[model samples]
Target: MVKTKIAVLVSGGGTNLQALLDAQREGVLTDGEIVLVISSNDSAYALTRAAQAGVPAVVCSRKALGSQAAFEAAISQALSDHGVELLVLAGFMSILSADFTSRWPRRILNVHPSLIPAFCGKGFYGLKVHQAALDYGVKVTGATVHFVNEVPDGGEILLQKAVEIQPGDTPETLQRRVMEQAEWKLLPQATQMISEEIRREKDQ
Candidate 1:
């Protein structure tokens, strides 16, 4: 099927990564095979998930590597080793430089926990995004899957699903809701969409 070789970059609990694994198990992710997982933290739970799924995983800790450049270099080398064709940032914490993004162009994807252009960009991640949405009194918050570019969260969006903000929603509650209703579903869908695109391009 010429499935796209995918590498998931993660930094913490890999709920999103687990979603991709589950999608593959159920045949929802037909055009993409998750070949590797690269984690920025050595102790991240995502590694355990990857091990259980039998996916090869590696860690390139920013602190242990001692610099962002070295950390990225390690990740680049691993991706090269695996011949990864697509990169997915699933709760990945590092900010990739322009040099790195340029190397992959539209081949990188990120799932941000917001509708984007809303509670995104610098200082917007994890629970902070949901807190910002609640602070602004927004009735709806969601997730956005986009192509990663130089700017933070400033990439061409691929998909988004609006999750309603409840009356008594806290940041934790809202974050969970967004993941349940949006991130998990959209990440796999966007992955398949891009995987199919890559397969077609490769065929031609």
Candidate 2:
């Protein structure tokens, strides 16, 4: 069986990266193997996680790049150089433009911290999402993994898992719950699905 070469993009603590790594080690993630991790922040703990995993990681600081185009180009160059066949935006903060996204089409994946169509879009991310959901008084919130497209969090949905909003749940608590119950489980599963798809196509 062929394993799809994967690269994870991150900008913060690599809890999601750790999940995928744990899954891979546990044999739950069989169809893909993470080969690289890219971070927008050089100081991000995600880079350390990558190092501990023995996965190559590169830093492309947007502040240093001086522009979104330059930043994305640097990232693209790194990805291309590494021969990354599958891209996973685990917690990558920078928004990619249509030009960059178009090259990968459905080959890229992102896990948004919301159920999608709700608490999702350009301005919604991280704790802001959970805050909005709690502010809106929604009883349910979860996570969504989707194919990357030009629109932020507007891509085709691959998988979603619902986590209930508990009584008096703060945004931080909800975010943690959503990550553990939804994001952690869903990402690896989606990775498996996409990886299997890619492998099947490759083996053909």
RMSD in Å for all candidates: 0.6, 0.8
Residue-level lDDT of model 1, residues 1-204, one tens digit each, is: 789999999999999999999999999999999999999989999999999999999999989999989989999999999999999999999999999999998999999999988999988999999999999999999999999999999999999999999999999999999999999999999999999999999999
Tens-digit lDDT track of model 2 for 1-204: 669999999999999999999999999999999999999998999999999999999999989989989999899899889888999999989898999999998899999998899989889988999999999999999999999999999899999999999999999999999999999999999999998999999999
The C-alpha TM-scores of every prediction are: 0.99, 0.98
lDDT of 2: 0.93
- Candidate 1 segments whose C-alpha is farther than 4 A from its true place: none
- Candidate achieving the largest lDDT: 1
lDDT of 1 at 120: 92
Roughly what TM-score does model 2 have, to 2 decimal places? Answer: 0.98
